[model samples]
Target chain A: MNLPCIVTALPAESRPFFEHFKLQGRELNGLQLYSCERCLLLQTGVGKLAAASKMAALLQECPDITGVVNIGIAGADAPIGTQLVAGCVEDAGSGKRWFPHLPPLRALPDLKSVVVQTHDKPETQYKNGIAFDMEAAGIFSAARGKLDSSSVQCIKVVSDNHSSLVSAIDKSQVFNWMASCIPVVDIMIDLMADPIRDQVRQVDEFTESAAQKVHFTVTQLHQLHRMTTQHLTLCSSLPTLYGSDAKSILQRLKDELAATPLSYTNPMVKDA
Target chain B: MDTIYIEEQISEHPRTLAILKRYPKARLVSIDRYNEVFNNASQNFRKQKQNPALILAKKEGERVLPTPDQYHIGGQHNYYFSHMLNCIYDCRYCFLQGMYRSANYVVFVNYEDFFADIETITAQHKKPSWYFSGYDCDSLALEPITQFVEQCLDAFSEIPQAWLELRTKSTQIRPLLNREAIDNCVVAFSLSPEEIVQAEEHKTASLEKRINALQQLQAHGWKIGLRFDPLIQASEFERLYGRMFEQVLSAIDIEAVHSVSLGPFRLPRDFHKKMIKLYPDSKLLSAQLEYNGTHVSYPESTEKAMIDWCEATLLSRISSEQYFPCVSS
Candidate 1:
């Protein structure tokens, strides 16, 4: 099963996610890796270079990792507690930019997303229109090549806006912000991981014996999976039918479904 | 309206300036070229959909091309031009979701250039050529913002021999209603059973609203067409489509209707894979499908059943001359 990787710049920023998932923490290559069955939360110390190096290592170690979500406390120009999704992450020093891809329904729908600038240091004065963080560009740039843009999300809740620079911000308050965001983070994890879990469940339900007998190619396997999932959801659970191979089974299923009477999945259809 | 990314070349374009003025609140960022952002790797189709950005750029190369002959509706020398890429509606069956990496809407503001290309193509044919406006995007869904159809109507008017088809599932026909209906243009509306529309065709005008719009357009002397194209598969579809036809035929004068086209739901294998990945849980995508060569669709028997039933139901009402069942799509 492919699991989502969660990366945070600081251990403090990673605490709430760790506490929420109740992950057993371990250290690999001098970086902390906290994980559960569905996800792994990796904490990179500080700054862009650290974020990039640690993220690169984490993905290298977990080659099957599906996607990554980079979460941390960020200083934005908005209210102190405003939650923001990063639409674009710009590295200020080199003027490089990465538009972090977010999945449609998988993201927290109502949060405001904005452009974020990753700086060498915290900005106390330049705070009228965007978000300033130290790690998103690094994490995104590193994870981007290994994943699709939509699968990598860089999101944050405000710890300090224009009120204070990184130096004057309270650590405990950042902890509270991180702690409160646990529920939202959990929701994201569920949205991202549910498809993976469902796919596994489907494979389990499909029966390995029949699969081995059929010797279906990759495309045929996916086609069967798609048909089975739809049938289970809209019509009925797939039944064991007599067939010599995968092709026969698919054809038999088609015959069965075609013979079945019309049943609409959407309730509005019943009304119509 | 989400954030909009601008290409550096088109930042100073007059049309781009007008669009930016409309969405004053949207964050505008500049990229070196349109593809730099639109073609970015690992972009999630579903996530970007929630807050899709608007990418404004200048379209280059082959502005107009021949439509796959299978998509014809009694037009000679059929060609389609897209002022935009991707669409506003999130229809589950649309091929656009799989065709592009990003769900964001990209509008090429160079209207004059597209018309100029059409002008060149029109001169090549002795018979009137057909220009389809909604191949890549809805014809009128963004009419209020782009006002492209309004401009297209004017451009088509100059070449009276050229026919324009603004195919859409949009109820935004005020621009057409406000002006006199042009004889050369056919405003085609896509139709399906309300059950399928509700289940899969998200953010489109309802069946009732579309019929109402068609009735209004007919009243204004516009020639409309019924696009039962991409006919979706479901249980008891005949009963559903039967009732739909009764409602639709009863609503308008079939004689005034320009034509009717019926094509089964089909997509290239690669597009289907992309769509399945984007919408893992979509029941419509999961329906019993047959992989035929490079494309996938309902099994031949099932496809025949759908088209045969619809044809029997429809041809019984309208003449066979005006009805075209697309053999393959």
Candidate 2:
């Protein structure tokens, strides 16, 4: 679940990534998926509609993927080659808006933070400081129901600016820019992984295997999960249980905890 | 906070202007409404809690609401109002983590509206009406920045029948000490064992600091109250709580105390589920809990035993008339 999925609209934007990660590729129902041990990349084609459809399909295929990152080139008024992480993304066609929970940016000093606006057509007129892209909003919309806002993010490199029109840009230049920005992308992925790592699983492999051996009703299954979670957190280990069913196992766990009188508190101060 | 979100409608508000002046380096973003960020789905509450931002917006609609059935000190009619949405302190057992989607603090800048609502409600009642201020957020934690308690004291000074209780775990009492003590205002401090404070109440003042602040307020002629609600369970419950109570009671004059209340730790069913998912490793949440259909709390027998012990210990020090046991709703 800590593995972050990357979405790119064109192969030019993803070529350097696939080469850098040494990703192996496959075609799943006409969609391209490139993956490595650490990450997954999806080539979502060129527009909002196509990106949305393809990303939605990828999520359905991989439901456990917790993080989605849309990395590609964008047109902005700033200088070309300037990299930025989106603070807010809006769809120009529908006037819908979304704000991503920002990861701490102090550590990533090189990446500029900016607002992004997604458009249906190439933009000749650019707003001051806003990045214009074709795929961020689509990736966000498709992943909206499946992931948390913080887990879904967009990081864009400015390939075309006000002086240079997007139509004149070629794939080779896009690959060069993306290749140079790979380090920043790696940093972003690592930063995003920190929060996901903090999320602990209530049911570990041992607990899941134990439950399978017992005949637990849905309610009993939930109770067993809680009991085992408590046992792991407070007691530090799950002792041998001699119960025939879920009810008896749950009672034994409860009784063991009761005798101990739960009172362990981690001394670490995690609040800011 | 590194970022501050301001609603366009309240961009020019005087309070908002003053606050922005404090953090000139923070990145400011403009929005049409606070909910656009505060209510956004799929926000990781724990992640945002690490670096929470400040959202200043004008609160519209009903600003004052009735308090829960058991949330009262000594009033026939009781109500609670929140000028702020989230708290500065991160207590692991807090229900706020379950209640909110995003961890960003939302401060409603329309204090006059809340005061007007309080005045209106007080006029409708025959006797004095009680108003609780810290149910949703700490009344004094961010006092210097919000300046809310100062404004609230001024407003409550006008409506004598409206009793205002400023419950807090923060040691920010400079504002209260700077002004004359008001009889109608009770500065209530939520107390817990030092062990719990170190483990669970992450950013709050230590037990010793809270006692010092409470005693300072009492000496200034302010009527102080003690709140031990959501009494956390521990292996050495009697020794820890008994010592904490002794430390607090010995420091302050009992005659100046307004009231004392105690209640068990509990949360609505949905909130409990959400919190567990957020902090699966949390020992406080992982403790054996009794899940009735609608809420979760310590097992009934354990809850009863803890409450009975604490109540007896508290009643021994204070008069029965001064003690109020908050019933589970």
Candidate 3:
């Protein structure tokens, strides 16, 4: 199965994109459908924290998501009307930075390697020398930790500048700005998503048969016993997100399955 | 259960002597003094030889010391401590094969001396210190046999400022659960994707099992850490990691997690060479990697990309303060 390439956007930034991709007249949760290409793009609300949480939720819901891209209007260092694909995201509060997995910017020399910094207020970008964004950092951070780095891409069009023009930019301007760059967004999405989609398909093919095969030895079973115990130690360190009953059921399954000696007749008893 | 025999030696090293004093009850099996059983045939797991593991014991004035790799765990503090050698698990890429002359485990029964020396050094330094276990052997792999973590936890608990980081791929948490959680102790588990764990990290717990164990400990109020060091670059790494992260987050509560550290695959140049020699056919060790000074690591671009991805993902789920990148100096 091909993992989805999730896109995070606000109500304004999402409307036009959803309209552009709308296929039959059906809409799901304010998100319109494109061709059933096995990609899931989500409108993860606005702001860094919300975007981060939404991205996490998306990843949890769709473990097969091949890649992630955060598409929005960014306040670039260049002219207010300029278009640029952000190559990295920097957190202003923390010196930590994230380099998005876009195609190498070698061909686009005019495009600035924009750093998208996140803050509580839009005014925080005055001190930093780049674009201001509410969600890129959160998306980048979430994608980076949950997925491989090469699978995250951030494409932002310059909607406003660090100048007083930033405050003048309203919700309508953000939508118009994102709408104008629909073509560039399409290009960026293809560039970032195509390779990852191919890779995910390959992984699915490989793991499918391997997942079906079950081969474990008695010695391996003994080792699995020790491994399960150690796994219990590692899990015990984390807080409980699920119910204790679920945890116990999973543990019991692991114990029983891991303890079962691997015989040719028992196809279920196999190596992980 | 193959056993490799060893000859005995008496050393005057204070730490070695001190350890021997604690293990007065341990039997000392001896071979010829001149025929140093340092590298037995069965013990050598070098790539060229496929032999059974070895088991060795010695009689000394106070300690039974095992030969340990000098700098096994790198990054925070340079430390070398080994209560035992060799793990119960037979990971294909493990350095224990090349670094050790034998695959047999050598458990130093002396605990008091190890603690004494640790206390002495800890007292000397005012800065918060870190003592790493699971270098020569997994700190908790053989918990049922030796109950080593129990003793070490007791010793580390006494020192207020000193920190003890028990690194392991094992899921043995019974001993940890039995004791009171220590403030200065951090129980860090080495994690990999389910695919990597199944293929390369042979004899290790499943990813789900490990996560469950981590969750249990966090619920019990233990400060737990996630170590995604030595991340293997596999096909569809993003999907693998994405699923892994989702699985972890859904199964684990983010608030209780103390810290998460991510590092790409790394190995000392010498250790890499030795490991390659020990496992010439190992796909993991044979992967294309560049040598950065004395260590073999992923290419700069790849490492940066992987680390960047992991850092971002972790920050989204947890606070930035909780994420640590194990960068080499």
Candidate 4:
């Protein structure tokens, strides 16, 4: 997976996030960009078209995106400053929608879950029981294909609501709410980042290095993977397992696996 | 407080009507189907878990069916079903957490249908069939609102050939205590060391409260079973568990105890991946577990030691006939 990209609709939305993270180099199109070791942050000016355009460009540059995080102020039927994770994001213009399947990451303690409606223009009327935003649908549409929907997350801090008490809302306060939520958004990105994928990479590296010493056919390699089954122990104990050289460990495990009486019903198998 | 999502099909259901009445302030959202919202791809489980919504839907499929062979609790035809999808208590080691994509509770409001399905299954076999509740969710934690335990007891009373096991970690035993206990039903309490319960079983009743609930139920003529299932492994696990048994056995009536079951903490390889990423900081999930075929768990030696210690501790209080070791016995 590529480094995660945090996309915001406004400069204020991106300002806090951009400041919080240390980025290395950045590329600019219409929107400003900042990137670091394995992540990128972009300010997708405002509205749906800008969001889609900037997202498309970001994906083009980094094809293997871990996930996309959309953070901005939104209008909802909740208290102002309340943070929400988008459960279902809908494009108000075409009625097209996307639902990002999120596995349990167990982060974002105080934020609520809400269905977000992405409007092309500023939404004044929040009659429906959903939060209103300007960019999630566009971001989701582009990111869903590149990554799992569960990895694609959107963090919205409520700036206004249908029954908002204040006649005039403070702009700086809106920016501040989004700014204060940078930590939560970062945690969400980290939570959504696949840990298993990282473990798989370690496994792949160990397996590849081990295979380089001995010539194993495709069938033998498949059998080895089947025997190991990506167990966590094998991943952590890779260094110890392949002592001195890869050939000995490879030959030993392979011999052991071949000798094991395979059974369908029994889950108890000898770990390599 | 969280929002409540309702399937349009069951908006008029009696249980749905009763739940809405109980939680009137909860924001209500109507969806065409439960999956439309429940299965949404963009939802964050961690965020939703903070304020999990309540989904009321209709059960259309087979509501009662046999459980996996490994999940058998001494029955020839062991079957299980859920009136709910997710549980109220957020146990870190619970299989439900890994099984479902969503943490939001989905209660199928069709209780009568579940019972009717059970009737069909029981009639097919003359031998007593075991029906396990709380496999997908807890049987009595939300009893005050769901009333699932009460409803299931009513149904089990009629079917003498049916044995209902209401497994839970809840301290809610007033309903069972107030009523005449049925011979066919067993109110099983999931037991773990106080330290383990405190660490992994989030939002569940404390060990002391659960022990109280157990004693209360046993005194009221309700058959009780202790489930040390999904037993977690640690450095001093045996010492902690042996002490726990002494405290538990000393408090409750050992002769009245019906059965004790011990199981190891294990999860599907895929689910283990999902859970580890979900709670990376969790010591229980982060423990260097080995993948055994399709499932991941502590190494075989560690698993064996835990069961042996726990079985010895339990056997000291009760007879071998009264105890069942899931993996070993």
Candidate 5:
């Protein structure tokens, strides 16, 4: 099963996932491009707009990327440290709300469904509810119209109380804390890989079938000729069974012969 | 000349009708006419395409003239005056969209009636009165045609106690630059972070362009005001707003500024519901919101947090006296 290419807005947020996927290469830009046996990881920047742009660039760079999982920290109304899997990302600025599909997280035991309100700042804890951090909203907004909703997920760990968390932690500590959430990242990556691979297989089968229908080999053409001969023999017998019906059957036999797959060996053959 | 399209001619109740009757010379075109005007490419806003009826018919409103929530303007007795009906900019959260049916610009060209009413209101109140423009539409957005602000400034300059505030997101300051800055008038600009402006405020001037205009206005000695109204929720709001405030303060002379007002995402309940219906897919409108009486504002705690944070952050640079929380009264 091919796992999704996991992208994080913050390098610290992507650390655990990046560490899990062994680095296979580096880009000319000097950013390390890592690839595990099943997963791919790229660092997106902070905030909704920045994160969204990065995710888009990543998708363009890797069109084969079937699924995108945006992982990071969020502020919640629940207990400060509780983890949440965002079901929706609401842009507080534009009042646009997007619902994401996370089948893997849904299957988990006691996984909480949350609506992450993306704000310009870390909201101080209000009675309304927990608000998630910056990049998720941008990531979702950018991805919503671009990526299939079924293939995008935002999994976040509660990093702080809205008010105190911003003040208590230094920049480095926030990065370290994000780096430690690797186990959760691995499980989400593994969960999504199977479905993506299955989708690829289905697409491959469809492509092959479409290609075969438009192009025929020598063997297929020969087989088609044998079938036509049998069909003609049956048409020759139809007149004895029903007089007028034989005429219609003969017309159908001619149409079928015209529609038969042509051999590629013919000079007039067209590419499918 | 931009053709005015009127979708419907609703005869407002007697009181409202009386106000319209005062402007007997003002033309009333059918609503279909507006659709035709908007359908033209040259007449449309640069942002998003226009939708909904452009003009809204309101019968006599006792508060047709709404009192500007004073606290919002740093204790100024602010009264918002709308000369036109709708805004050219299609900001996603604008109340005018929800409050009115039409998207066409309705120019109540009977500048005489509006000025007469303002004269009466100012005479009744002896205090220094600040009359705000662009409450329902951008004051200078369509100034090329309307010339409403220019007329109002001319009329209000005669009244020593009357102050006109042309609150807008437009860099159309040519009207103001053409004339002397009315001592009583403060040309305020509604500013949002660059991100919000690009993503949500369709057709509004860019923050950089707006700041440049503001700097020019300040250099010319025009009284300036900064409005951070309807702040959006985002992960980097503080950094964005803080940076925005810092940038404005640094670019312009702070002392020449009139006042600064900060508000959160808030809408009147009816207006909010109407806006939501207008934009069912709008992420800003659909977010969970609690009603604070008739006002549909963010939850109290969220509102408080946002306001308090803004106040604290703004106070660090400007004095508390310079800041106002245009709270619902």
Candidate 6:
């Protein structure tokens, strides 16, 4: 699977991810890009618009990066340094909400699940029991537009709550809170990335080699691919291509497959 | 459902309140409308299916819709209504996975509106009409939670001219058994061979359980239906389905059966495409199927042969008058 790209709002929030993932700093398409073998971290300047723009551009440049993890610091009613995984992200201005596909609780047992209300500026005087952030909705909207909802996730560490004020928060404290969340953050990244890996279809080397031997149109290739998938699935192997011509071979394959009784064994069933 | 999304309009609705009381520990989120979450663009159906939340909203607009020409039992005028959007069971071949982008269940709590619409439609027809439930979801799957069937039975009792078909693969029949069997309601159960049930229909009642439920309902004097719709193909399908038919027919007094329907496994072109994407490794979706313009199904001759075999087998057990083969429009 392609490495999950981690999008953070500010450099302070990105620092823990950078050090943890050992991401090397580089400039990509005029945006601050950090990367390593495990993940890619993009530091979008604070706020929703910047996160959306930078994240969209990064995903556009790297189309293979299907999974996106938006991690940042947030103000909530919880104690400081508490990590949260967002069940829903709502734009306070537009009343728009995005529920990122939440994995099973057991997969994220350590982090509390909360609704994240995203605003234009940092939120203070937290109420309503929901976490407040500036960029979760933006990152989610952009990533979901590019990838599936299952591939997009946002996690935040509580930097300020009603007891503590936003202005009282410092970069060193933010870094410390994020550093504490690295274990759970790693789990979330793997949880998002694993599905993409499982979704990848096994490469059909035989089909590729067969296409090389015989020229096929674009439409023919699609048909051939589906036909080959069915043939392999039912018969467990493809019939030999005896004839030199593509039409004759295709016809022979189709004829043989039709006569084969449509039988299937469910993979989930044991002793099938 | 761990989290319940309640619309502000129906937050205080009696049904909504009852549901809230049932799931007391559920996280409640207030929404202006259901589509704000349900009809959103970026929702993923497969992932949501794993841990789906319930969206309790008042269904607005045209709640009653005319059934497709091919969908009916005996009545000339047929319609279908959905009190719930998604089913609890996940059959690999179900079209709901293709039709809706979200797997979250949306239960329209306004049962009075649906019954009112049904009443209006029946009155407009001025004749016996059929209103089929379970088109978009299994009729009795979440019976205890929704209590939809109890209210539906009461609604149908008031309108004797209208026929209510509660098609399901669920074994939740206690609610029906607790009340007197209404003549206008037919408690239909969707049956398949045990092999198919085990393989494809995930989280549904076993064939034995469904038969047991139907038999109890039949004994209670409720009209029961046998739905052999979406007939799947197998190498030894004749033997498998034949044995199943024997088992099912022998269990119930065939004379008590209200109707039996047969349909081939088929889906609209777009729905088939979407389903294939959701379950690429599914052998059922990967079968060497034929596409006839707008829908996909078994090869013409193969489908005809299977139907012929099933028809012949069923004919031996029941008369032709009770059979209904669903034909495509």
Interface RMSD of each: 4.4, 5.4, 23.7, 11.8, 28.0, 4.1
Return the TM-score for each candidate structure.
0.83, 0.93, 0.48, 0.72, 0.48, 0.92
Candidate numbers, best TM-score first, in rank order: 2, 6, 1, 4, 3, 5
Error of 2 at B156 (Å): 1.9
* DockQ values of all predictions: 0.35, 0.41, 0.01, 0.09, 0.01, 0.41
What ranking emerges by lDDT with the best candidate at the front? 2, 6, 1, 4, 5, 3
Q: Candidate 4's interface RMSD, please?
A: 11.8
Candidate 3: residue B178 Cα off by (Å): 1.4
CAPRI category for model 1? acceptable
| Residue range B85-156, candidate 3, lDDT tens digits | 677777766767667655445655556767777777677667756677766777777777666689888888
- Please identify model 1 stretches exceeding 4 Å from their true place: A1-5, A15-24, A27-31, A36-39, A47-49, A60-67, A71-85, A91-96, A102-134, A155-200, A204-227, A234-262, A265-272
CAPRI verdict (incorrect, acceptable, medium, high) for model 2: acceptable
Q: For residues B1-329, write the lDDT of model 6, one tens digit per residue.
A: 66688899999999999999997656566778998778877767877887788999999999989999988888899999999999999899898988898898999999999999999889987779999999999999999999999999999999999999999999889999899999999888999988899888999998889999989999899999999988999987887788889989999999879999899999899999888777766778877688899999998988999999999999988988889998685
Candidate 3 vs candidate 6, lDDT winner: 6
- What TM-score does prediction 3 earn? 0.48
Q: If both were scored by DockQ, which would come out higher, candidate 3 or candidate 6?
A: 6
- What overall lDDT goes with each candidate model? 0.80, 0.85, 0.60, 0.75, 0.62, 0.83
Q: What's model 3's overall lDDT?
A: 0.60
TM-score of chain A of each: 0.70, 0.90, 0.64, 0.72, 0.65, 0.83
Rank by DockQ (best first): 6, 2, 1, 4, 5, 3
lDDT score, residue A188, model 4?
Answer: 69
Model 1 Cα lDDT, one tens digit per residue, B85-159: 988889999998898888888999989999999999999999999988889999999889899999999988899
Candidate 5, residues B96-129, lDDT tens digits: the string is 7666544555655456677777788888876877
Worst 10 residues of 3 chain A by lDDT: A234-243
CA displacement after TM-score superposition, residue B272 of candidate 1 (Å): 2.1
| Error in Å for residue A185 of model 3 | 72
Question: What is the C-alpha lDDT profile of model 6 across A182-232, one tens digit per residue?
Answer: 887787677665442432343255667778999877766666666676666
Error of 6 at A257 (Å): 3.6
